[model samples]
Target: MATEIATLGGGCFWCTEAVFQQLNGVLEVESGYTGGQVANPSYEQICEGTTGHAEVARLTFDPAVVSYREILEVFFTIHDPTTLNRQGNDVGTQYRSVIYYHSPEQQETAKHVISEMANVWDAPIVTELSPAETFYKAENYHQNYFRQNPLQGYCAFVVAPKVSKFRKTFSDKLKQF
Candidate 1:
């Protein structure tokens, strides 16, 4: 089995973690903080938007079952990459749309996907494509927030919709439960 990692930030980590968890090849989705100078940034520090860290979901997957391009395609679909430093009502640099690629190939694939997705959206794509950085895992409460608190207000109104869209659009890619 070939294992690969993909670190992505698209607004809230809760939303991104929920969406990727349903994918077939994704082994695990860890909510984390990255692309920042802080060694171990707390969620509070991230929320302040001064740590430069974006709330991210680091995914472990098998390339044989899912390609990096496919992961990126779903990412672009679930979040508004055109919006800078925001997704829905969530605002701040920590909520910025970003792709922290693990390899040269992943970086190229992200660039290609971003370009292709630009035609799909009306505004310019502002999603950042950077090399993978030190990922500080988020607090345990955030690990599986959507799954643990589906009825939570933000999860119900925001994360749930993104998960629903991912399910509807990528039904064929879903894992058998």
Candidate 2:
């Protein structure tokens, strides 16, 4: 099985990470910061919105079972791509909708997906597609946040609903859970 990487930022990494974690061919999802001027930024710094970084999730997936296109399909559905630099209440550049494509192929796929989605969404899709950059894994506490802290305030109120939505909307793509 050929494995590939896809880095994406759609609001909070915890919400983004939770949805991908349940996918059939997704091998791993690392919550991290990317697309920022800051080098090796921390969660606090990224939160401060001074480092110009977005909270992103670096996912490792097997394309044999789940194509990159399918991954993009799920991504668009799980979050609002039209809301520039924000997802729901989470605002700022850190919460911007972004796709850090790993290659030219991924870049094309992302664009095609976005164009197709244009027919679906009434508002313009604001998802930014860029070349992937250095991925600094967030602190251990940020990893597996939804799974580890399902009952936590934000997890329960925000992330969990997104996870449930993904499960219901893309039940066929979901892994056994």
Candidate 3:
């Protein structure tokens, strides 16, 4: 089966990872950092906002089952694309809304989706559309965080709400498992 990858950064990677993991045709969702200057930056370094990396998730999906536009549809729905370099209380360049497109087609689709989203939204979309950069896998503990620590404070407070919204909005796209 042919699969494609999509990397996106919109606030904490935990939130994005959790959301994408629930979708059908999504093969794997790994949380990480991308669009950064530093080489192999640690989570601490990226959080400091100097590394220029945005907290991102690398999602591999079966393109035949779900289109890239569908993935972007779920992405834009889950987070605030208008907030530059920030999502809720987490404020920094690393938390910025960004789409690191892997190909020319992905780039065009991303921009078109953003334009469509902009028409529905009154605020200017601040989501960055950049070419895909080196993707540094986050520390081992960061992967599948919500599934591991669903009861944790940040998971309950931040991630839960987003997951709830995603589940409600994209019920048809969710996998049974």
Better of 1 and 2 by TM-score: 1
Q: What's the true lDDT of residue 49 in model 3?
A: 90
TM-score of each: 0.99, 0.98, 0.99
Per-model CA lDDT versus the true structure: 0.95, 0.93, 0.95
Tens digit per residue, CA lDDT, model 3, 1-177:
889999999899999999999999999999999887889999999988998899999999999888999999999999999988899999999999999999999999998999999997789999999999999999999999999999999999999999999999999888996
Superposition error at 88 for model 2 (Å): 1.4
Score residue 27 of candidate 2 by CA lDDT: 97
Which candidate model has the greater TM-score, 2 or 3?
3
Question: Which sections of candidate 1 miss by over 4 Å?
Answer: none
The ten-residue window of minimal lDDT in model 3 covers 31-40
- What tens-digit string does per-residue lDDT give for candidate 2 at 23-64? 999999999999889899988899899998999999999999
Error at 140, model 1, angstroms: 0.3
Kindly list the per-residue Cα lDDT of model 1 for residues 1-177, writing each as its tens digit: 879999999999999999999999999999999999888989889999999999999999999999999999999999999899999899999999999999999999998888898889999999999999999999999999999999999999999989999999999999999
Pairs in steric clash, model 3: none
- The residue ranges of model 3 lying beyond 4 angstroms of the native Cα positions read none
List CA RMSD, all candidates. Answer: 0.6, 0.8, 0.6
